[model samples]
Structure formats: C-alpha cells, structure tokens
Target: MKYLIVGLGNIGAEYADTRHNIGFNVLDALAGASNIAFTTDRYGAVAELRHKGRTLVLLKPSTYMNLSGKAVRYWLDREKIERENLLVVVDDIALPFGTLRMRTRGSAGGHNGLKSICELLGTEDYARIRFGIGGDFARGQQVDYVLGQWTEEERRLLPDRLKVFGDAILSFACVGAERTMNLFNKK
Candidate 1:
C-alpha cells in the first residue's frame, strides 16, 4: 500500500522549533531514522520511506500553514493515493503538551491548516495525527505562544515524544489508524 503522510508547518528559519512546527519535527525525525532525505518537490519537500510492505511518501508542505490544502491535494493526485491513505500530522493547542490524538475524521477545531485542507478536499473523511502543543499562553497571547520556541523543559522531553510520534505513524501504516490510535492514545 502507498500512503501520503503530510507534516503541516510553515517552511522558514523563523518558524523552526516553534510549538506550531511539531509536525515538521516529527517528519524530520522519522526520515532521519529511516535514513532518507527530502527533496524539494512541486508543492513541498518530499521523501519516500518503506516500513514492512508499505510505501510512505512524507511531505513537508511549502504552502505555509493556512494554505496547506493546495499542496496536499496536488500530491495526493500526483501520487494517486486514496483519500483514506492520507494522514496529516499537525500541532494542536487543545490537548496538553506531548499529548497525541489520531482521529479518522473531525472538524478543523479552529486550525487554519486543517480548515484549508478540509475546504479543498471537500470532506473531513480523512485521517490526522494531532500532536498537542498545549494551551499554556496568557489569554491574549495565543499567536505568540503558538509561534514561540519551546521551553527548556519542553526541549528536554521532545526527543522521546517525537519518537513516539514516529512510531505511531509507522503503526498507522502497518496496522491501520484505529489500532494505532488505540495503542498510542492511552498515553
């Protein structure tokens, strides 16, 4: 089977290591562990990796966070991957930091990346991995917090958290999202 695993984030030095870029971080870790490198492609930086018998195409969209759907749609059509085989990795502020949630379908939950994707895709019937960045900011500082760098404590916990995110993705490809969700969502 083939899967298009897209990690949503803005591409630039300014956005690097921010809480909002956790999706990119997860893909980078996964690619590094698989000994693969991404090449700049039509709508994103893309790399291919295999786990067991499945082919996974990893993408870090260059379309920026709010316009991510264009990149996703392009790649999905080009790769001929089924809608069910698409999984988007995105950061969510709703859950506590380091929390992971995999859902088969849902609303955007106030995320522009997801909103654009759903708008372009014309449906919410797709899978997504929402990595929690947590809502730890002051009442009016949401933007700053989301775009801010990780705290020293968050940095210490990141490697292990990213590893689990990588594993959850692999599990989703090999065992299916439901099983992966059951396994990882308990943590």
Candidate 2:
C-alpha cells in the first residue's frame, strides 16, 4: 500500500516553528521518530518510510502556503498515489491550542494552503488533519498571528502536540481516515 502525507508550510528559516508552520514541525517530528530524513526534491522535501508492509511518502511542500497544491499534485502524480490516500496536515485557528480535528472531506475554512490544494486537486474530498493554533490575537491581526512564533507556553506544550499529530498520521496510514479520525479527533 502507498500513501501520500503532505504537510503544508512555507519553506524558510523565517517560517520555522511558527504557528502556520506547525504542519512542517509535525512532519519533522514524525521523520525524526521514524529515523528518516527528508531530502530536497522537486516541489518539496521528501521522505519515505515503511510500516506494516505499507509505503509512506511524506512531503513538506516548498511551494509555500498559498501554492501548496502544486507540490501536492506533483508528488501525488509522481508517486501514483490516489487522492483518497493523501493526508494533509495544517494549522487551524478555529479551535483551541492542542486540539486536533481530522476530516475526510471539507472546505478550506479560509486557509490559503488548503484552498490551494482543494483548487488544484479539483475537489475537497481528501483527508486532512487540522492542528488548532488557537485564535488568541487582537482584531485584524490574524495574519500576523498565524505567521507569528508560538508563545513560550505554547512552545513548551508543542512536543506533546507534535507527537499526537505524528501518531495520527501513522494511524491514518495503518487504518484509514475514518478510523483515524475516530481515534484522534479528541475534544
């Protein structure tokens, strides 16, 4: 079995460890735990892993946030993986911090990264794991908030959150979107 895991984030030192880049951070932690490293390739950094006789293709899109779909599309086609087998990890400001929501299909909820992917894929039927970054910003500061660094308290709590995200990714591959969603989408 083959599965494609796409973590949406901008590629740069400036974006590292920021709220919008939590997707990248989760994938990085997943890669570390799997003892694999990502190599720069066409569209993004790619890592391959095998678990329970399944081959997993992990991608961290270098196309930035708004253009993430380009990398996702390229990798999916190149890997010959079906859209249903793809799982996107992204930050969500709608829920409280440390909250996780997994969905089989849905709208982007105003997320440019998800919007790009949905547009390029021509549908919103793929699976995605949304990591809540919490809406804790002043009025009209949404952009700065999403792009901003995590607070000291959040940073301290991030490792555990990333571990959960990584486990959710593995569960999605080991089981399926429905089962994984049931297993990980805790309030």
Best by lDDT: 1
53, model 1: CA deviation in Å? 1.0
User: Per-model C-alpha lDDT, please?
Assistant: 0.95, 0.93
Off by over 4 Å in 2: none
Q: Provide TM-scores for the models.
A: 0.99, 0.98
Q: For model 2, which pairs clash?
A: none
Error of 2 at 130 (Å): 0.2
Estimate the lDDT of model 1.
Answer: 0.95
C-alpha RMSD of each candidate structure in angstroms: 0.6, 0.8
Cα error, residue 144 of model 2, in Å, equals: 0.8
lDDT of 1 by residue, 141-174 (tens): 9999999999999999999999999999999999
Per-residue CA lDDT of model 2 for 54-147, tens digit only, reads: 8999999999999999999999999999998999999999999989999999999999999999999999999999999999999999999999
Error of 1 at 154 (Å): 0.3
